[model samples]
Structure formats: structure tokens, C-alpha cells
Target: MHSFFRDSPEFEQRKRRPYSPPKVTLAQVRSAIPKHLFEKNTAKGCFYVARDIVCAVVVYKLGWAIDPFASTFGIVSVAVKWFLWVVYWYAQGIILTGWWCMAHEAGHGTLSNQNWINHVVGFLMHTFLLTPFYAWRVSHHAHHKATMSVERDENYVPRTRKDCGLPDELAAKLSDYHEIFEDAPIYTLLRIAVMQVFGWPMYLFTNAMGSPRHPPYTNHFLPWSSIFKPQHCNYILISDAAIGAMGYVLYLWTCQVGFAYFVKLYLIPFLCVNHWIVMLTYLHHCDPTVPYFRRKQWSFLRGASSTVDRPFLGWAGRFFLHNVSHDHLSHHLFSSIPFYNQPLVTEHIKKVLKENYNYDSTNSFRALYRTFTECCFIEDDGDIVFYKNKNGKTARVLADDALDAPSLH
Candidate 1:
């Protein structure tokens, strides 16, 4: 097996140059891909949306039918029923996730060239998933603009050594921040569990990984929150109202169906969707080898360069996730390019960026765990810095030649 920090031969071979800012310009990135991929096919986008919805409905109805018809096999065991329930939730969750990604496409203006049409579809589908569409779209736009920027990137921002309360004296002495309690393996497990289950809601409600520049307790729901301007207050309120309406509908459904049945039918799959989305976004930008930039040394291309393209969930991910994680670097570079068109764009992007392109083929679930444990904190200051683990060691070293003058900013 490879080292947990992933000093894999493939990674080393791909990156002949040490980490530095991207040399590719936005114009160069755009010109690398074919022009037809940039076109938005509204009808094609609608077909995908409809297909996902139909699949979800079929899964839901067939899943319910299992209970009544189980006796046809001569008294189904409780264990068997439980297994089937798990399978149903997994299937249902994936279908809905595909639908969710289509709405995400709308947010990027790739669902259709018609802005109003995109907004309407995004609003409805995101509301169905109980996410605030406009709020997320607005914040997600900010995330893309400032990705990998230590001072400005919106989510999954690495905790700095000072932010984690590591002692400056001890860190300087041993280059380690292994606090007695926090460095324990048991503690890491607990942290990962809590993050996987609660991270999404925590971020949405409290902006957990949001910029520190925001006032304390800033959240996605508030119109006046520091993440938004006064001019965008109406959009924020509309998103909040849509969420409220969706919540009310779910509550009524829960009352009608009863709690246990509701959990089996809806809540379990919804939880899975949350888990998948959180893991996708988190693993894309968080890795031991990935560098996070301080704004003084930041550029759009450099920030985009910092992300890794992961083959999360293999073929299922392609079909169910619209290649959101698999072709993520291309998405970062050309966000308006539709998901269906991203594969070709990604191929050219990898060619253009070459050593700057990062693709980690690690199993997504294992990679998620590895990242959570190893990508702990960055130095309190540096124009470009990679994550350090509890022992304060970086998985990859920056070459002397790669260092640029801080004054270059």
C-alpha cells in the first residue's frame, strides 16, 4: 500500500516541477477546448433533469413495494428487509444526487443560456433538496473566484497552526504540533465521523469553513450576513423563503407518514446526498500535497491549479454525479461549460497544464479519510504552503527553484 500521505509514484512522475503558481492564462485555457462544448443545450439539459426525476420516482415506488411483497418468498427475515432498505436508500440517494448536480449546473449558467430559465430550475431542484439555491449560487460563485486562497476561499479552508492553538515555541523547536489530546488516533476518528455526518449542515447554517473576515456566526440564510451585500438581500430572502416552504412540506409529509417510515423513505437518502456532496467538495480542494495560496500571491489560474481531479465512485460517479469531482479542474477553469462537455475540456486542460494538473486516483472513501487526518494545518504565514500533518511534516516538498518572490504579487 502507498504511504498514507500518498507519496505515490504516479504523483511524483506527473509533477516533475515543484509547486508554483500556474503559468497558463485564462485565455489559453479557453482556447484549448473546442468551441462547441461551450454551447448550452437547454433541451438536452431538461432531458437529464427529467430522467433523474423519473428514476427517483421508480426507485421510491419499487422500494415501498418490497415490504408488502416480501411475504411472497415465504416470510422474509428482518435482516433481509433491512438489507433491502439499505439498497433502496443507496439507489434513491444516487438518483437524487444526479438531479442535484443538474441544479448545480444551472447555478453555473450551464444548464441553459437563458438566465431566467436556469434560475427557475435551480431554485426548484435545490429547494426539493432543502438547499437555498440563490444563497448557495452566490456563495459558490465566491468560492470559485477565490478557491485555494487562504484569506478568501469560502469552504474547507485549512486550519492554520495559530488557528489550532499550536504553541509557536514548540512548533519552531520540533516542527510538530502534536498536542497530547488532539493528535490521538481516537480523536482523529471522532473528528472524521463528526465531520462526515454534520459538516454540510454545519457549514450551511454557520458558515463553518467560510472566510474569517466575516463577522462571527455568519450564515447562508441571513440576507444581512457579511457574505452578502445589501443589493443581494432580496435574492437571499427569496432563497430563505424557498427553504422554509420546502421544510414545511417535509414536516407535513413526516406527520402524515410517521417518523420511522419517513426516515426510511426520505431522510436516509437525503442524508446520503449530504454526505456525497460534502465529500465531493471537500476532497477536491483538501489534500496533503495541494497548496493553499495567500491572497498576495493569488491569481485565478493559480487558485484553480491547486485543485485535484479525483475519480470518485468510478462509473457510478460519472453517471450519477455528472463528473463533478472527476473533471473538477476543468469545471474550475471553465465553469460555464456544461458537465456533459467537461471530459473533452479536461483532456485538453491536462495537456495544457501538464505538471500543474493534479489527478489523484486514490479510492475516494479512503482518500477522504487520508485527507481528514493528514491535511491538518498550514503555517500561520507563507505565500504558498502545503498542509502539514500532526507531526508537522508535508507529504510533498517545495523545490528551491519553485519559490517565487513574495514581492511578485
Candidate 2:
């Protein structure tokens, strides 16, 4: 990979001189989010909590349906029932995702007025999904406070070509995009599912990886950005205990109801929630145009609200993902406004921010696939550059050269 970049003239042209830096300022982006919206509070956060309760009830009902029907069925009928189980699995994913969103609201102190109420709700909701509630809450809030900051961002920092420790075998493999995707997808899934629950704990406990900056705080529930201190540690343990309790209950259910039926009808849907989570954050941050700031250019407001919006998914965004879509800019700004009021205020802020407000109505799934395939690694000049490869089509290489490789991230 180094040889390829070094040998190619285009790489030399695209290689960064010294970083010139971006023109946009933190004050400018902060100014875009209206002050009133930042302060706005709403009861709708309760609606999301209620929705999760309702969705769980519906899922339980569906579980009852699947179990009885599967048991009564013949071999072919059982196969058919299991196939229906896949659909239920998807529904379970959505529901768990919704529950996670509510718990996230609790993290943001949006689900209720009281701080203790938020902690209790978040702990309960996230524990069922095997997520460390306080741990995730702290990291995620840090993500908001430091969104696009390349150095400070909590999640999804894109590694530059120079930074990639690509050995010859891996470099040769990367030469063919297929091998990289094949390798990356496995890691991506593990990251999206296993890492958030398990890896999150290690980061909190050991200060290993994907760890939040440890802020000095006397209170775990109160708003103090940039650190995950000892005070919040108990909440994560509480979350783990809840998971242990749930596991024991599941064991009882398996014994009474039978393991095959238990897994088929109940567990599959529960795991699907991870899909929504993986997709949500991926699409939220991974736009072609989104800038990842270096430390000098980074600031709290710019980092907080630098995220873009997806079209049509707004309600679902708020409901299943907390008010991330609507209240996001304000969430970035204040970090205190509850999720329920986020949307109405976000819209109001958008009206105020106008062109300065970042949003993308473009189809996200298509873009996600394209970027995942094309922009896994970035090439840096003085500025960070994402490039599209030229495959005999008319191309836009920044320096107007037809190099064998085009830069991308």
C-alpha cells in the first residue's frame, strides 16, 4: 500500500502538505442551533417510553402465538413457523432498538424530569439488551460532544492511509476490494453487536479502547461532558446485574416452555435490535460530505452538532433512536434537553440555522453500501479527501490527473 501510494504520481499530488485547516468555526455552527430550542422541554419523551412498553407487550403476544402454533405444527409446519420467526426476529430487533432508544432518552434525562428517574429507566432498559447503561450513556454523550473530531470522537474514527498499519499481505488483499469487505463485514458485525455490550465494559473498567475521556464528577447523573469517571461506574454494574437476572429468568422460561420454542419465538427478535443500532449510527455519521475534524480545528459546538439528517426516518429516528434526528443539534449543544422535545425544537432550530444546518435527504441505504464499499479508507492532502474511482467514466480527480488509484474515505 505504501509502495502503491509512493509510486503513484497522483498520490504525491494528493498527499497532504501541512494541514491548512477548514474555514468553518465552532461559534458559527453553535450559532446555527437556536437558543430557545436548546432550552425546550416536552412530555413526548414519555410517549417513546410508553411505546417501548407497548411494543414489548405486542412482542410477548407474538411470542405466545409463535410458541403454540409451532408446537402444534408438523415438520413442514414447524419449518414454516421458524421462517415466520425470522420476521418476528426483525420485529424484535426493531422493538429492542426502540427500547434502547427509550433507555437512551433516560440517559439524556428526556424520558422523565428527574435525574434518578432517568438512571433507573436507562439501567432497566439497557440491562435487558446486555448494554452497560451508564457506560454507554457516557460514551455516547461524549460522541455527541465530540462528533466529527478525528482525535476526540468516541466512535468510527476513519484511519488515514499513513496511519493504516497495512502489511504486504493485507495491502495485497486491500488491492482487491472484495477481500477487504469480506474481512471487514465480520468485524463490523462483531463491533455492532458484541463490542457495544462487552467491549464497552472493558473500556470503562480498564480504560482500554473506545473509552470515554474520564471527566471529574461528583454526580453520575448530572451533565458533565468529556469524561467517564468512577461515579458512573455503578450504573454499568447495575446494568450487568440486570442482564444476569434476565438470563436466569430466560433459563426458567426455557425449562418451562422448552428451549427450541424459547429461542425461536423470543430471542431472535430481541437480537434484531442491534441491526437498527448499527445502521442508525452508521448512517448518522458516515456521509460522503461529512467532515472529521482534526484537533486544532475541532471545538465543542462543531463536534456536538456536526451530524447530518436522514429523510423520512425522522419519527422512527426519534422513536426508536431517541430524538437524535430532531433534537440532535440541540442535543449536541445543550446535552440536557430531554429527547421528547428534541424534534419540535430541532425543526425550529433548522428554520433558524438554514443552509448552515447539515442534512441529507439522499437515500441512505444505497449511500451506506456505496461508502462501505468505496470509502473504507481515506486519502489525505492538505485537507481530508474522499474520492470516487474512475472506471472509464468521466472522473473528477482533484488535481485533474488520471492516476491508477483515486483517493477515497
Candidate 3:
């Protein structure tokens, strides 16, 4: 029975194997793309911002007007109303997430050719959304620099069993889900839920699930936190002040319109933005197929190649998320590449890299489930390590032994 389960179609499909990076250089990959694609248009970038903002406003107002009427019907009507409202929230969230991505572009200075324009736009967009522009910019730069380095990457750093800090027995049990939940579906579903809903805020506030290099008290919002240097203190304070101002504005709005109105109009959509942020970043970097490198084995190209480009909601998702999901590997490769050009860049790289390229067309839901369950923690001992399941087996091993294969120039 166990052997049959292992050979099952679902198990085989979700399994991921390690991929070796190509010997091709970034210069060679960049030269393959058309030079015109590198151009950034400030007007075009602002158009996207304008379009998403207008759409978000429409969705918010529509939901606000319909919500009271939806509540007036029967229990079924209330359910339907809520269902519609949640859909609107999701739409609004996607638009706001687009704004967040625009700010992210500003951080990379890819939103426009002008550096000052990037900063000005990034600060306003991020601050309005309660993110500290410069604070997040510095840390995000570090994340891009380190990528999948186990010791240095800022976010989504997985824990080794010993590093997890759970009591020994509980750690062992949680690590090996086969021994605990076994065939129970609820355990998998519940774990994904917790990660999606709570992960982002926890990372921002407590630095939870961040680099182990950081002290236990580390937080993104604190100027003195280990994540930043003293030089960054002023910017961190500015970020906090921006967030505080937004919080005060929210408080005033709640006082004016009541708490429930605020929850429906802004809070739920805000949570949805967090959800997209967590889910996309998690899926991009964490996979059974991807390996994390310690200092000795790490290189920028290797670390950047560790990411996988995934599709969300097809073209609509690509448009809304500003190609962040589909062209992620290219973004990592050339952090300055504008989102408008990333798809073209990715295509060029894919053709040039051929077998060395990593693209996963797996269903997003399936990939999420598999990643959450299978990518529990990596073995701490190896210089280059793949994620291991509870049974001490690697989650997925390439059939060709490609992980040990030599690079081809």
C-alpha cells in the first residue's frame, strides 16, 4: 500500500527535483534580448498606477453600496452578499497589490528611468499602503543580493529541526507528518491557512520566519533592529511615522463611518494584499526542487536561479501582479529590469538556457499544497541541501542525478 501510494499520479506530479544552473553568464543572457525592452517609461508606469487605482475605487464603492442591501435579504442572501463582497475584496486586493508591485519597482528603480521619480513615487505608494519605503527598500535589496543563501536571505528562511526551537519530541513529530497527521487532509489545509493569513504581519512585526542570523527580537519596523544599520535609523523612523500616520487616518475614518464599514472597505482588501505578498514570495522561492546554498556554495547566479516562475490566474494575474509571478527569475537576474520588459527577458533566458532553465507550470493550488507539506525544513549539515521530508527522504530527486552533474559552458 505504501509503495502504491508513492507511485500514485498525484504524488509523482507534485514531486520536484534539483536543477543545476547553466554555465551561461548574465551578460550572455542579457545580450540575447532586444535592447529596446530595457527602456522604462514613467508615463506608462503611471498609467498602470492610475488604471489600478480607478478599478480599486470602483470595486470598493460598488461593494460599499451593495453590502447593506445584501444584508437585508434572508440567511442565503447574507451568504451570497458576503461571497460577493469577498470577491470584491479580492479584486480590490489585486489592484492594491499591483500598487505594491509598482512601489517595489520604485525600490529597484525600474518603474522609471529617473531615480528621483522612483523614490518619490515609491514613497507615496508604499506609505499610503502603510509600508515604509526606504526601510523596505534597504531590506529588500539585501534579500535580492542574498537570494537563497541560508545565512543571509531576509525573508522566508526555513528552519532546521534543531533551529526550530520546538521541544524535541514535538519537533520530531511535526517534521515527520507521516507519523502525526498521516492521511488526514485537515492538517495540510490548516497549515496552509495559517501561513497565508498570518505570515506577513508576523514577519513585519516580529521578524518571525526571517533569517536566523537576526536576533529573536528583530523587527522590520524598529530602527535598531539587527536587520538595519545605524545609517538606516532615520529611514526606519520615517517608515514608522508613515505607518503611524496611516494608522491615525484609519482610526479617524473608523470613527467617522464605524468599524464595520472600515473592515469591509479597507481592512479585508488590505489583508488580501498581504495574502498575495506571502503566497507569491513563498511559492517563488520555496520548492522541493530548489536548493538553498550555504556561504561556501552560494553564488549570485545560483541563488537567483533558485527561484521558479509561476502563473497565477493566467493573463489576468500576470497583468494585475505586473508580471512579478511569471517573470520572477529574470527579475532576480536583473533587479533593475522593469516589469514591462521582464517577460521578454525571461523568454530570452529560457531559450538561451534551455535545459538549465527552471519553469514550473504546475497548478498553483497543487504547488502551494505540495510546497507547504513537502518543504518542511532542509537538512542542516550539507553545504548544498535539498528539502527533506519527515521520513529522512529527499522530497524529490532528479532521475538523471543532475544535481551532481557537472555544469556545461
* Candidate RMSDs in order: 2.5, 9.3, 4.4
The window of 10 residues in a row where model 2 has the poorest summed lDDT is 387-396
Measured by lDDT, the strongest candidate is: 1
Candidate 2: which stretches are off by over 4 Å? Answer: 1-44, 67-80, 166-228, 231-233, 312-319, 322-330, 379-409
Tens-place lDDT per residue, model 2, 14-68, is 2322222223454554466556544523355556667778887887777678756
Alpha carbon lDDT at 201, candidate 1 = 83
TM-score of candidate 2 to 2 decimals: 0.69
Per-model lDDT: 0.82, 0.56, 0.78
TM-score of each: 0.93, 0.69, 0.88
Model 3: residues >4 Å from true position, as ranges?
Answer: 1-18, 68-80, 164-184, 398-409
Instruction: Give a tens-digit lDDT track for model 1, residues 357-397.
Output: 89988767778877887887888988888888777778777
Query: Cα miss at 384, model 2 (Å)?
Result: 5.6
Residue-wise lDDT of candidate 3 within 1-409, one digit each (tens)?
Answer: 2231233333345354335556677677778888888888889877887887787778878987776778778778878788888788878888888888889988999878889889888888888777788888988999999989899998788788566433354345544546543446886798778778777778888887788888885788888888899999998898899888988999999999999889888888888888888888898898777778777767787788778887765786788888998999989988887898898899888887675566777677777777777776776666677776555457655444545534321
Error of 3 at 183 (Å): 9.0
TM-score-best of 2 and 3: 3
For model 1, what is the C-alpha lDDT against the true structure?
0.82
